[model samples]
Target chain A: MTTMRTETSTGAEEVRPKSALEPLISAENVSYHASGRQILQDISLTVARGETVTVVGPNGAGKTTLLRVLLGLISPTSGRVTSKPHLRIGYLPQKIHIDPVLPLSVNRIMTLTGSFTQEQIQAALEETGVSHLNGQSVFNLSGGEFQRMMLARALLRNPELLVLDEPVQGVDYLGEAELYELIANIRKKYSCSVLMISHDLHVVMSSTDRVICIDQHVCCQGKPQYVCNHTEFQRLFGRQFSESLSVYSHDHDHRHDISGNIQEKNQ
Target chain B: MTLLDDFLWRAIFAGLGIAIVAGPLGCFVVWRRMAYLGDTMSHSSLLGIAMGFLLQINLILAVFVVAALVAILLFLLQRQKQLAADAILGTLAHASLALGVLAISLMTWIRVDLMSFLFGDILSVEISDLYLIYGSGLIVLLVMLKIWKPLLAITANEELARAEGIPSVPLQLIFMLLIALIIALAMKIVGVLLVTALLIIPATAARRFSKTPEQMAVIAVLIGVASVFIGLFTSLEFDTPSGPSIVISIVLFFFLSFILPAPKTYVLR
Candidate 1:
C-alpha cells in the first residue's frame, strides 16, 4: 500500500518547497517488502542539479527498485517520493530492448522517442557516433550499438535528467571507454544530470559528482574518497569488502581479521 | 460497367478504410499477443447487435452500446489482478455471447437478421454503411496519425511514455475506444465470427516484408484491400462465402510472403 498527496509549493511540485535548487528528486524513508520479507529499508536520497550519482551495491541490493521509484515507475511502500513537475527524463533499461514485431528503423525509434526535426536526429546520431546505424533495424543491433542507440534516443529528448541501468555490462573495453567519454561530453554539452547504475566503480567513481553506496538500503553516501574508508562498510560486507578491492570503495586498513569469511582480490 | 463499377468502387473504399485502421491496431494486438482479446471484443459485438433487436433500437447504436460496455467490462475485469487477463476476457466474451444467444432464443415476437451480423453481408451492404465506414475510417486513421508518435511511445513502455509526458493511460483508453468503434463498424462487412482474421492476417503478412512500423502499416492496408477484392472475385466465381474468401486470399498472400524471401521478423508464432 502507498499514499501520494500533493504538497503545496511556489513551483509545480510541493516537494521543492524549500527552494528551487532543492534537488529534483527526493525519496524519504522509502522501503520495499515482498513475500513477507524486506528487500529494502529506510532509503533516503536526493538528486541535485547537474549531478551524476552512481549507486553501487551487491546483487539484489534494490538498485533497480530505487531507480524505478526515482523514475516514477514504481511506488515505494512506506515513504514519500516526489519530483519536479514537467521534468523531462530519459531512461535506458538494462538488457537488449527490441520489439521484434515493431517494424521500425533506428530513425523511427528516434522519432518516437520525442518530436525532433531530421537535422536534430542526424546531429544526435552523429553526437552519439551512431550515424551509420540510422536506417538500421534496432532489432539487429549489437550490445555496444544498442547502448549507443539508447544514448541517441535520450539525447533527442534533451532531458533534464538521464537514468541508465547497467550500460557497460556486456561491452568490451573500447565500447566502455566510448560510452564513458560520451557521457562526459554530453554532460559538458547539455549540463543535464545523470544517475547511472554500475558495478565497475573504478570506471564510474572518478566520473560522477557523488557516490551512493547501497546494500539492503543506502549503506553510506558521500564523495567517492570518503565512503571508501568507512568502518561500517567493512563490518557489514565482511568478505565482499575484500573481494571487491578492484572497486573504488575498499581500503587496505584491515590490520585485524574481523571475519575468516573474507575473500581476497587484487588490490 | 456502371452497375459493376458502383459495387467495385464501394467495395474498394470500404475495404481501404477498414484495412488502414485494422492494420495498425492489429499490430498492437499481435505484439501484445492479444489474439484472444481481439476475438473476445468481436464476439461481444454480436451480443450488442442482439440487444439492439430486443430493445427495438438502431442496430448500429445497439452495437456501439454493447461493444463499448463489454470493452469497458473486459478492461475492468482485466484489472482484477487475480485472474489472468485472457481468462477475464474469455469469461466475459463467452458469457456475453451466450446471453446473446439466449436473448435471441426468447425473442420470438420480433424477427432479426442475425446471419447478416454474424456472417457479414458485405455484398449487400447499403450506401449508408459505405458512409459509416469511410467517415469512421477517416476519423480513426487521422486520429491514429495525430497520435502515432505518442501512441507508440505509450505502447512501447507505459511508464516510459508517462515519464516522457505522453499521458499514456488516457491516450491508451482513447485508442481502445477507437478500436471498439472499428470492430463494431467493420462487423457489418467483415462479420464477427472471423473479423479478427481479417484484422490480423494482412498485418501479419505485411510484417513479414516491411522493415519499419509505418511501412508495415501501409503494406498491411494494401494487403487488406487486395485480399478483399480477390476474395470478392473468387467468391463470385465459386459461389462461396465472402469473409472466408477474403481470409483465404490473405492466407495465399501469407504463403507467398513466406516463399518469397524478405527480411525475417519472427512472425511464426
Candidate 2:
C-alpha cells in the first residue's frame, strides 16, 4: 500500500524512495474487544498531514470505538497505533453533558482543560463565529451554538490534528451543512489534518480526501466517489442507497450568522 | 480562661475549618453527581469507628484507613459490573453500618457513647481536634487547588479529558482518596449520618449565585462559614444538638437561596 512504509534501521536501506508526505497518524491491524465481543477487527488506516479523512459506518458499527482507540482514550485489544512524536491533537467528543447544578460559562468551558489568555479565547470563539457567547451560561446555549462552542474550545489548543466524533449530531439540516462548511474552512485556515466520524451515508463532506466505510471492519476505503461505487459499500448500504449518496460540496454565496439569518458575501 | 481553652471556641474553629475544605470538594460532589458515593463512604465510617476501638488505634487514623479501603473496594466492585452502581453502593453502605453496630454492641467490656458517634457532640470538641482539622483541612485545600483544573476537566467529561492527555484514571483515584480523607476528618464534627449534608447543602445553595466553577466553590465556602456561625450561635442559645443544628442552618440557606432571584444569566433546566 502507498500509505504503508516500513522504517529502515540500517543506513544501507535508507536509499529507498520515501513518500514526500508522512502520515500524522497510522494504525496497523488494529482490533478491539470489549466484554467478550469484538468491536473492531484488523482495521488499518492512515491520516496524512493536511488531509481530511471521514469514517462513515452504520449504528453500532464500532465507529466510536475506532475514534477512541485512535485518540488513545481506549487501547485496542490487538495491533497498534502510531503517531508522530509530540503530536498535538484537539478532540471534540460526541457530546458533553454539563449538569445544570454546576454553573459554567462559555468562558470557563474554553479554559476547562488548560488556561488560555482572554485574547486567545476571543480569537478562537470569533473563528467559530460564536464570539457573542463568551460570557453566556452553557445551559442557555442552543444545540448548534453549543457545538460551535465546543469546536471553538477544541481549536484553542492549536492542534496539529483535529479529531471530531459525530460533529453534526442534534443539529438541523441547515445547521449540519453550515457546520460542515465551517469545518472545511477551519482545515484550510489552520492547515491541520482532520479525522472525523459520521454515521450518515447519504451525505459525505465533499472536502473529505478519503472515506473509510467500516462495519466491524473496513468494508471499503478510497475517495468519496470510489467508495460510493464500490460493491462492498453497496452491500453494506444497499446498492440503491449507495447510488443516491451525494458529496456535500459548499457552493452557496450566502452565509448564516449565529441567529440563522443569511448574509451576503462581501465578494 | 483564654479562647484556646474554651470548648465553644475550639468547636467553632473546628467547624469553620471543616467548612472551608468541604465547600470546594462539595462542588465536585454535586457536579460529578457522586452524592450517593459520599453517602456510602460516610455510612461506612461507623465501621471505621468500631475497628478503631477494637484495635486500640487513633480513631481518626482508623477511620481514614477504613474509609479508604471501602472506597477502593467500591472502585473494584464497580469494575466487576455485577450490579448496578447504586445497588452496589446501597449494599456496601448498609452492610458496613450493620456490621459496625453489631461489633460495637458485642463489646460489653467498653463504655461507648453511641449517640455521640452517631449524632456528633461538636460542643465538646477539644483543642487537639482543632489542630487536626486545620492541618488536614489545609492539606486538602492545597491538594484541591493543585488538581483543580484537571479535576474540573474530568468532571465535565472524562473521555475528553483523557483525549487531551490528562491522566484521568489516576486523577479519579486521587479524587476518591480525597473524599475518603474529608469524610474521615469531618466525622468528628458532623458524625457519620450528617456528614454528606455539610458537603452538599452549601454547594447546592451556592449554585444559584455562581457563573463559573471557581465562583461556585468560593461562594459555597462563604455560605458554609455562614451556616457554621449561625448554627453554633443558635445551638448555644437554644440548647440544641450542634451537628444537626448546623445541617439545619445549611438547609435554611438552601431554601432561602430559592427565594432570591437567580443570577440573571442562569438558565433553569
Candidate 3:
C-alpha cells in the first residue's frame, strides 16, 4: 500500500526545464479490487501538461485498469481521480476487434466517435502514414497498419492528452521503434501530454519524461535512467535487463526510415 | 377503400412496417452477436400474453413490460459472472416460455389459440395492430438514428468509445430496451419462436452486398421487405403458414447471397 509521487528529479528537470506545469490528470491513493483480488493498491501518479509518463510493469499488473480509471471509464474502489474540466483525450486501446459481420471501413472509423472534416481526416491519416488505407476494411489491416490506423483515428480529435495502451502489440521489432519515434513526433507536434503503458522494458522510450515501474503497486518512479539504475527495477526485472536498458538508451543515435533501414542521426 | 378494407392489404402494410424497422435494428443484434438475447426476450413475450389475458390489459403493453424486465434482468445477471451467458439466456428463455404455456392452460375459461401465438397469424392482422406497428416502429427508428454514431463506436470498440467519453453503459441499456420494444412489436407478425429469425436472417443476407454499416442496414431492410412480400403471396397461393413462409423466403435469400461474388472492397480475413 505504498503511495509514490511522480515529481521529476532535479537533474531530469534541468534537462527539460519547461516539462512541468499544472497537472492535466492526477490520481490519489487509488486502489481497485475485483473478484476479491486487489488488482491495484495505493497507486498515485500525475501527468502534467506536456510530460510523457510511461508505466512499465509485468503482465496482470493492473496497468490497463489504471488507464481505464484515469480515462474515467471506471471508478476506483477507493480514493479518487481528478482531471481538468473538459479535458479532451485521445485513446488507443491495446486491440480492437471489428467483427467480420460489421462492415466498417478505416475511413468510417475516423468519424465513429466525433465529427471531423474530410480534410481533417486526411491529415490525421497522413500524419500516421496510413492515408492509403482510408477505404480499406478495418478487418483486413496488417498488424502495423492497424496500429497506425488506430493512432490516426485517435489523433482526429486533436486531444490535449493522449492515452495509449501497448500501442505496438502486434507490430514487428522494426516497426516498434518506428512507432515509438512517431509517438515522440506526435507529442512534439501536438505538445499533448502522454500517459502510456509499455511492456518493452529493454527499449523504454528515451523520450519518456518519467518511468513508473509497478507490480500491483508502484515499485519505483523517476526518470527512465534513474529508475533503470534503481535496485527495485533491477530486482523486479533482473540486473541483466537493467544493463540492457542502459545500453539501449546510450545507442539511441540512429533513426529508422519508413523502409526499416537505419539512418544516422542528423539532429 | 377496398384496399384499406381488405385483410390481405392490412397484413402487407403491417409486415412492411415491421420489416423496415427490423432491418436496422437487426443489424445491431447480429453485430453484437445478441441473436440469443433477442430469442430470450421474444420467448418471454408469451408470458406477457398470458399475464395480459389474466389481467385484461393490452397485450402489447404487457409484452413490452415483460420483455423489458427480462432485458434488465439479463443485464444484471451478466454482471454476476457465475453462470455462462448462453446458459443464463437458455434458462430464462425456456423457463418463461414454459411458465407462459402453463399459465395459459390454467385459464381454461378463455379460448386462446396457442398455434397462432406460437407461429403467428400475420394474415389476420387488424388495422389497430398496423397503427401500433408503425407508431412504435417510427419511435424506435428515430431513437436509433440519434444514437447511431455512438452505438456503432461502442460496437466496434467499447473501451475506446468509453475512453473517448461516450456513455457506453447507458447506450447499451437503451439498445437493450430498443430490442425489447422490437421483440414486443414483432411477436404478432412472426410469433415467439421465429422473431429472432426475422431479425438475424435478413441482416446476414445483406452482408454480401454491403461496403459499410449503413449499406448493410439499408440492404437488410430491402431484403426483409422483399421476403415479407414474397412469403405472403406464396402463402396465399399455396395455403401455407405465412410467418414460416416468410422465414423460408429469407433463408433462401441468405443462400442466394452466396452465389453473388464477394463485395469488391472487402477482403475477408
lDDT of 3 by residue, A124-150 (tens): 999999999887888888899999998
lDDT of 1 by residue, A76-117 (tens): 767877776666677887664556777767888787746788
Q: Of models 1 and 3, which has the larger TM-score?
A: 3
Q: Each model's C-alpha lDDT?
A: 0.74, 0.85, 0.86
**How do the residues B1-269 of candidate 2 rate in per-residue lDDT, one tens digit apiece?**
48878878888888899899999999999998989999999888888988999999877778888888988998889887568999999999999999989988988888888877877777557777777788888898999999999999889888888888789877877888888888888887778898999999999999989888889999999988998899888888998888898899999999999999986667666
Model 1 chain A is weakest, by summed lDDT over 10 consecutive residues, at: A1-10
Say which candidate scores most in lDDT: 3
Q: Could you give the interface RMSD of each candidate, to one decimal?
A: 3.7, 1.2, 1.0
- Give model 2's TM-score for chain A to 2 decimal places: 0.84
Taking all chains together, the TM-score of candidate 3 against the true structure is 0.91
Residues B1-269, candidate 1, lDDT per residue (tens digit)? 35434765665567667777788877776655667877887888878877887788866667767777777777777755778887788788898888887788788887766776677666666567777877878888888888787878766656556656577657766776777778877786667787888777877888878876778887888888788889777877887766677788888998888888786543322
Cα-based TM-score, every candidate: 0.84, 0.91, 0.91
The list of candidate 2 runs beyond 4 A from truth reads A1-20, A246-267
CA shift of A24, model 1, Å: 3.1
Question: What is the C-alpha lDDT profile of model 3 across B227-249, one tens digit per residue?
Answer: 99998898789988888988999
